[model samples]
Target: MKGILKKVYVIFFISYFVFFTSWFPGLSFFNNSNKVELNDNVKLQAQAPDYWPTTGWRASSPESQGVSPQKLQEMEDYIVSENIGGYIDSLLIVRNGYLVYESYPSHIYDANIRHHIFSCTKVFTSTLIGVALEEGYISGLDDYVLDYFPNRTFDNMDYRKEAITIKDLLTMTSGIAWTDQVDYYQMAFSYNWVQYVLDQPMVHQPGEVWNYNTGGSHLLSAILDRETPNGTLDYAKTRIFDPLNITEYSWNLDRQGIPIGGTLLHLTPRDMAKFGFLYLNNGTWNGTQLIPASWVAEATTSFIDVEFDQSHGSGYGYQWWIYNWLNAYTARGSNQQYIVVIPDLNLVVVSTGNTEYQFIRLLVDFILPSAGFTPLNLVFVISLIVGTISLSILLGFTFFHFKKKRTIKKLRKEFFEETDSNGETFQ
Candidate 1:
């Protein structure tokens, strides 16, 4: 009996140790005692203007403020009530250049944290294509896919495949009958993802119809890699990231070592806001032309009208999503992450969430309406205060719950050992 008890105790201890090591390698690192302090100087410095202003003023606000307080409150209420899958993490509203409103859900407020942008990477990738075209790296958007890959050959290669142009891929009319469900991650990890995508079976004529193809965007990265002086990443650094002051970010690569243009770019919420702001300002930032104004107009302009409205009430524009709201355009990712840019309204709203289809509705019904429409400043202030307090209480409960669990676990182990010892003595 004593031997059996010893074996059980040893097994339990080993299992717990292994589980703790695997699941919480540095649990103490996250404790309040070791928490890193944020620099006070880096907090948002933008001040609200004395008077509620209209659009295009650029005096009190960053560029020019638009929307009313009532509308902004409506939006916030909608997001909170929707309870979209993931926490909203962070939301920022930039009208003109000034930061109008910003919020960070209790669990996700760090400025340096980079959340996965998913399909929004396509918008950035498309922007790079515009840069490549402007710099004369390639001839034009109409350049054939075959021109970029001379050595790589395709099976059933016909005029349709040969005739397929870079523009076709950009517009998602590549004529390739490929579904995104196939172990595309594995295929992308292959030594030649571009060749694999090109070799896909042709279902229709090039540019005949639209098919949302992530692989198509990867081909853009491949083409960029072939034509640019350096690689696509280097080109992006020089043309996009560097100019925008986006230093800390990451783009995942395919098996062939090319940045996956379709998805998997990680960026801080603020940096993501910068991208939207660049588009909002017509590709100009801080008095410098980062992206060509012409490209900004062209990219956001509806290139293809998707037949069905996405759950988010958005249409597709050259990798950008067109909001149902008065011609607003956005860069959207899975789980409701959005970089919404309303050029007509001079508004940019960035939100990250894990919710399902309702996120779009939340944005349309709630967030956008609140931007500039609320009646009284006191109401907004009271609501914000209440919301903050509620969130803090919720976080406190979560922290205490975990701490109790840890203590209970320790107690259970001790109790079990004592029970085993008593049982052994009786035997």
Candidate 2:
């Protein structure tokens, strides 16, 4: 009886560890996306023109942009309706260099707002690493993780700990035992977050297996801060945010004043779209290569097997969640904050809401089918706007002519009536 009870206890313990270590990834529980295929209508189209959004995004009708305008309206109706599982704060869609569709609740969130992005911040951290590598701030991804932190003391440092590389952290293969109980959640509250992260005992050899380690990500930020001239946040401000036109944003810092890269960033949905757009353009923004195209390719390419949702190439990028929809990859956060990029479709979809993972259904079920195959060119939009204005003017002139004729006819009738129903003029 004692032996049986001990075995059962061990099984229960292992089960709890498995369940608790991997935090809620905020995807639908019923996702069976690996076998799903792209809808025929959402097929890949020709390349979209390279248009820079310097000042602001240009607006156009969805239909004009090869996205069904009626479908967007219906999607908006659904967004506004109560059937939406949770509070959907905002949904902004950009396709072929135009802001074809956007929805927001004005009362809950301001028109220009930023909120907690949670784990999506990890992708931004990954971008900073790319910039660091491109600018020679970071030598390479294979460099030893501990080499950057010479001043810091790590407890129980071993051969595996020394073998951990920047890439290992980027890919979450550091083998650091960062589960729910012995993880970043507890480390965040500790007096020294960075030190606490460095002190974590290695559970597996470096580069052996992939496991989500928030502490390992924080170490990346710390390394960026150490290597960069202005520190991680400042480096990001000049390197990523300034170039991308992301003016309004804030990143949480630890007690050591180091930018917490693992989580706690507040960014607007549009700004999130800009980051996605930056990646979709392959590290280039307006022809200037902010991040090396090489790094972008490496970062976006599947480093390990991860099935986040139902679509092809559902693997983990540097920090991005590779989803199955339209072959999209995204910077996703808790509570449905996502900046999904569909390269083949030339689409960037940004959303922030309280509903967990239901937005995927919203996007795949409603948005894709409703979109058109062809790109919506800027020349067409300008011509359409001009045409609309010209048509409105013509209608205005026609209405004026009819109004003038009607007034004259009424006056003549009144005059004839006053003059005893014969030809006569009234005053």
- Which stretches of model 1 miss by more than 4 angstroms? 1-66, 307-315, 372-427
* lDDT (Cα, tens digit) per residue for candidate 1, span 1-427: 4454455445545444443433331432222221222232111112222322122212233223554666656666655666542467777777655577777754655667888888888999999998888889878888888888897678778778888998888878889878876736656666777777887878889887888888998989888887898899999999988877788899988766789989999998778888887776667666677777777777776666664334434456677766532446778787667898765445677877654444556555555554432212233344445545555555566677778889999998888889888885433
Residue 93, model 1: Cα distance from true site in angstroms = 1.3
**Against the true structure, candidate 2 has what lDDT?**
0.75
Q: What would the TM-scores of all predictions be?
A: 0.69, 0.73
Compare the candidates by TM-score and give the number of the best one.
2
lDDT (CA) per prediction: 0.68, 0.75
Q: Cα RMSD (Å) per model?
A: 21.1, 26.3
lDDT of 2 by residue, 1-427 (tens): 4454455445545443433332221232322222123233232223545578756788878877788877777776776674563477888888887888887753467547897888889998998998888789999999999899887788978999999999999998998878844576689789988788879888999887889888888989999998999899999899889987888899989998999988898888778888877777777788788877777767766768877644433678788777533356787777888888777667888888765747776776577667642222233344455545555555565677688889999997777787865665456
Model 1, CA-based lDDT: 0.68
Query: Which structure among the candidates has the greatest lDDT?
Result: 2
Clashes per model (N, Cα, C within 3 A): 24, 3
TM-score between model 2 and native: 0.73
